[model samples]
Target: MSKISTAILRGVSGAFIANSGVGKIGMPAEYSAGVQQAAASGIPALAKLPSDKFGTWLGYAETGLGAALLAPFVPSRIAGAGLAAFGGGLLSMYFRNPENTEADGIRPSQEGMSLAKDVFMLAIGLALMTQGDDK
Candidate 1:
């Protein structure tokens, strides 16, 4: 990957991650609902956390990850790995709740649509990691 390609990938993924975090802050109702629904996702006591506190902290973490991925000195591969891990967790959450997906499971239901968008993050993450050697 050329520097320009790497930069573009990081910029887009970082912005999306940061935007999602910001949305959690601005849309408390939707954010809280999503958090509550994670109770069956095998995430330990995530749902037990107070909604506001959970949302705030999650927002910070996502925002920080986005920022780190965008930092010039940060290794692209490392950033990509971090983003990929986060995407995996999100994807896991989706699978843990089958009702959120279509009958076929792979296709997302109405509610799972938002979660499905994380595929882009996963792809971008892998792209950054794989292309690191070329930069």
Candidate 2:
């Protein structure tokens, strides 16, 4: 079995990510468009997909990743890889948008605060990936 700390970390992060994904699954058209636009800034290929389709796909991906993290059967390495990828993508998006950062280009602007908070997800993923068999 995993350690209590690991379990709690995975449970909380997984639930939050899963809930966010569920909320995005049926997002409004405008919301979907906005999300797509932001994502496309980091990954230009994403622009090829329709806004609604991108939103739905993103939701599914997040849900699957969250489920993986929450499942004890899934190794920390695997789950962490998924979380790292997801978190990295979000960070990329945030960095790519000038409006998201301040004049220094590193600090989060008012518009970027939400995305900036995702850094903790990335850190947690890295920590999980580096954990020993105790996980």
Q: Against the unseen true structure, what C-alpha lDDT does each candidate score?
A: 0.78, 0.87
Clashing pairs in 1: none
Off by over 4 Å in 1: 23-36, 39-42, 48-50
lDDT of 2 at 78: 80
TM-score for each of the candidates: 0.81, 0.92
Top lDDT prediction, candidate number: 2
lDDT of 1 at 37: 61
**Total backbone clashes of model 1?**
0
Question: Stretches of candidate 2 above 4 Å error?
Answer: none
State the TM-score for model 1.
Answer: 0.81
lDDT of 1 by residue, 107-126 (tens): 99999898888778888888
